[model samples]
Target: MKANNKRDVNVSKFDTATKTIHVFVALCDNQYQGIVPVPKTIGNGQDPDNNLYWGCANGIRSYFKKSKEWKLLKTQKLDKIRMERLVFKHVSKNYYLVADAYDGQYIKKTTTDFLYSAAGLLKDTIKINKTTIGINGNAKMVAYIGHDGLMDFQLNENFSNADGKQRDAIILACISKKYFAPHLSQAKANPLLWTTGLMAPEAYTLHDALSSYIAGGTADQIRTKGAMAYTKFQKCSLKASKNLLVTGY
Candidate 1:
């Protein structure tokens, strides 16, 4: 068996539509330096951590900070990828979605290889925080109904187990009307303000849902309920100033 090195690593990674969160670290002379965050400024002042990207940034930082085998090289932000605006007549099928922020396209309808995208940009958005204790994301709803949380509805333990299967079921619940919004009090006012129809992608990848939002309306501007975000994208030119960019960023 190969021995695993726990202390350090050096690698390039993509973290945004404009660039990857690429960082290199090593243990050359046995000294330590703090980890580097991304350049949220993109083209301006000192880089901000907001752009290091979430989810994958944590462990990657921890790995190099402790390892004695890796060292920092260079972190480069790529030209933004521009993807083709994807429109779903009715979400007839699932397809791959890619980012193209810098290239000018911003989005590509990978499903066209098959067919379809979003039908709405309405913002009844729900984000599941799985990092919470047993059954994060209020996913227990699946088990509460008396199912196994997976293959069976009665297996309640699975929902509280953090088992991969349980997580999948919980995510599926978010997209369904079954996961009704509890009366979350006023404190949860809204950080993703002005952004509509923003659903967490789960294992699907955020790139899949970007265009839906990049094309939708703001919380304060939701003139139409049940209005589709994708169709809304068509209402405004890509050049139209979006008030939601402040929150989405």
Candidate 2:
């Protein structure tokens, strides 16, 4: 795996004081993606303000911003591939969350970036309150949210673990346990939360799981929190949600 050309040598400087969570969200695309089509208005990937995964009522930005645990810090417009970025800080914990919304057309890049981050091959830094914080590969937890691009295309790049340090990963895609198994193992990441079958990849599940995670809950406990959230929002049975939202290999 290739590392970022301009690396931040001081990325680990604040590791003891703060932890980072980096999330890559591929905006929902009705035309470019292979999933069953959604309504035209919200499925437009280029328009992050209305995209299903980024801007909708249940989207990451909207939902996380409304949470009492996370305080929205900054919002920035990025380049073409990555449309927007949101930074949030935990109100009670020394944790920072950075989420990037990738253009719908660049789902492949989003998936690749998540895998690279999980492998600890792509490290980067961001400044908050004049303090440099590690992101990407330096994040303690890396997550991929949106359509399962692996179901549409294959990746040729090797995502082997670049650093021996183990990181936690959350994949909120349909049947991710099956499709992401090989690459995830190669990346040597612990699966904190993932799905087993086709399901909606919404923000509630991630938010709830993080709530438990921040409270020092075990993997199974965190998974239960996510499952309960999914059940509450999706109006599904607890058994079904539990089966869908799983943790571990």
Candidate 3:
């Protein structure tokens, strides 16, 4: 896949003493092509105003903005890259948050290509020589929120730098646990938090999971909290909540 010259990216440091780096990647809006078909209730509903398209991404951003625990460090819009990068630091904690938003159109068979590419770019940017964040080791967490199962992509090789880094992952997408856990585990990303059957990419669910992680919740707690949040807000059947799963926790 060819790289788009137009991309928006930003980074900031909250604390140099912190040993963990959190990465969040929210893919392009739902209007992008190659979006997997979701249930009408969560996808193309009778009311267009209330849909799951980009709901997870928007929700996660809103949570950070409203929370006192997180302080905005920097915000940059790189119009040339078609991506927006937001960095935050946890108040009274040694954790830095890096969130990336891709605004370009999603290309089929190349979405993951861009996803890993963006991650690689961020990793390179945070290396000791590149930034003053004092990042001397690998990241502690890397979370991805966006469409999944629409296409297949390799994860093992893309994140080789994180091998044995004990970096946990929280993926908010349909059947993420089923489809992504194995590859992420093989790549040495431990204790993945994901879901099993079909699921609506709702913001509340992602918020809960992320909240749990911020609170130092274990992988099981993240999955449980996220499932419960989905059940409470989406009003879906209990079976939907049962679909949340954890591995390598």
The global C-alpha lDDT for each of the candidates, from Candidate 1 onward, is 0.19, 0.91, 0.52
lDDT of 1 by residue, 1-249 (tens): 001123111111111122111111111110111223223232111121211211123222232222233332322343332111111111221211211111101111111110010100100111112211111121111101000112212111111121122111111111122221111111121222122222221212222122232245443232122123323433543223232222311
Tell me the lDDT of model 2 at 73.
92
Which residue pairs show backbone clashes in model 3?
Answer: 6-80, 6-81, 6-82, 7-80, 7-81, 7-82, 8-83
Worst 10-residue lDDT window for candidate 1 reads 114-123
Candidate 2 lDDT over residue span 163-210, tens digit each: 797889999999999999899999999999999999899999999999
All models, RMSD in angstroms: 21.1, 1.4, 6.6
Superposition TM-score, candidate 2 onto the true structure: 0.97
Ranking by lDDT: 2, 3, 1
Which candidate comes out best when scored by TM-score? 2
The sequence of per-residue lDDT tens digits that candidate 3 reaches over residues 83-188 is 4556777787667766655442432222353234323323323533234552212345666666673444444345333323345666667677666655554445
**What is the total number of backbone clashes in candidate 3?**
7
